[model samples]
Target: MKTFSMSPAAGERYVPVSCPVCGESRTREGWNCGSYRFARCIGCGHLYQNPQPHFDGLRARYGDDYFSYELENDANFFDLMLKGLQDAGFFELERKLGDRRRFLDIGCATGMLLAYLKNRDWRVQGVEICEPAARYGVEKRKVPIAVGTLDEAAFQDAAFSFVHFSHVIEHVPDPRAFLLEVNRVLEPGGYVITVTPNRAGLQARVFRERWRSSIADHLNLFSRRSLVRLLSECGFSPIGWKTWGGIAKGMAPNFVKAPLDRLAKLAGFGDVVLVVSQKISRKPQDPPVGPPDGAP
Candidate 1:
């Protein structure tokens, strides 16, 4: 549960950015963390870090410290991922996929999830930004992992039947582009599961600027509505949505946390959300349509 500080390096370039989802420049000032500021997009209710660090600088944050953090928490993270997928009824979908079970994990740290899936008869591939983490997964875990960005990997078209990324899209410099790359690599009718913190959840409303996910490393903070919109725009149709993490560990007593967790799952509001979607067909060269409403 250690959050990355991601302190900006000296002379690192920072630039203002429009909302990645709705493509709007108008935003309301949001939480002010120590070194970074968030902005709520007026067009689509998307929260993102504005005047963000350059992509290269941001990518450089995942080094030795990040590797250690992922290594320490890999098992816990893998368990959570399994629970999330199970809650989303992913096993049924996996069965439906039959022998066409080519899977890809983006930003896969140490490849624990991929390893597990591989053992379950999946042909798995992984992309990791941190070199050490990728090396460890490849050498120790005996999993196939490429050390670089997804775009840099240049995978073949329609390469996978299942694509997964947990808590990774929020760190992307351009989520739309990242997703398009996903779309390009995903086979028709393939499934994609995205997991990220929910800015509109109860914890965020209560904690405001003090929310655990309001960290410098998270460039985008997505709500359910914003995320659905983004997924639709990126050629995915959401089939199921699941959320968990009502109260963070140690934040409240077990009695209080237990009920809150139940309520979070029942009411569709939680600290984190997992969206399961299927890729829809779209012309590769077609431009992304604008937001639904014309208010912009």
Candidate 2:
């Protein structure tokens, strides 16, 4: 993905926020990309943009320019998402998931992944915030895409068996609320696969503020621990995870990049991470207790 330029508009408001995962207010500056800055939470080691641009301004960024970018990179994104899902054993899981093959892809730009799975006998739907991209998916790709946020889609409870979102949660200003909405719509014991840039990866550490992913579009950057913790708290139990992309293109020679990529996957410190989790079934009278304090 290319770096996005998102300087704040004149007189635009930037709201400060606490850590979404742990509700921690203590944070230290992490990095800055253009006019945007990231802060690292002292409580859970979470990284997010503080003094975030107003929601309306943030929403405005996903117009025609963003649509063009998505259109240009749809094929590459599809391949990467497919590989990530395969690495997380989604293909085998799908075969054993009985007849309830419903799938929902959030932030499904152009609905490429939805169309691909729809061809594989899965009932597919998509939620995309970009109007032009959603229209393209619906009209050109023949995929059913709702042009709105998942919460705005207002799906029925237990609507889908599988939920997937790639490079999406980081853009959300309220990721906890987003995950709760995801949990509400997903059937009990259903699966959720999340792909996002890892803040605790080699690229972020090496490139620091210059990292491509530390761009203006991303509001939150999750590491493996922080993301898994957030998922568990949001009513899901992590089953598996995979990470890749140790060195980005043009960053290193092929010989070096190849080994680093393999090593990143094996060592669990890639630039991006894909986590697969199952929705924990909650009885109507179940306690409101949270996940274990230190369970791995």
Which candidate number would show the highest lDDT if scored against the true structure?
1
Candidate 2, TM-score vs. the true structure?
A: 0.93
lDDT value, candidate 1, whole model: 0.87
Clashing pairs in 2: none
- State in Å the error of residue 59, model 1: 1.4
- lDDT score, residue 42, model 2? 74
The residue-by-residue lDDT of candidate 1 on 112-141, one tens digit each, is: 988999999999999999999999999999
* Regions of candidate 1 where Cα sits further than 4 Å from its true position: 282-296
What TM-score does model 1 achieve against the real structure? 0.94
Number of the top-ranking candidate, with TM-score as the measure: 1
lDDT of 2 by residue, 1-296 (tens): 55554555577678989998889898876776657788877776677899887788887778888899899988988888888889999998898787889999999999999999989999999999999999999999899999989988999999999999989999998998999999999999999999999877889778878887888878888887778888988889889998898989898999999999999999987999999999998632222444422211
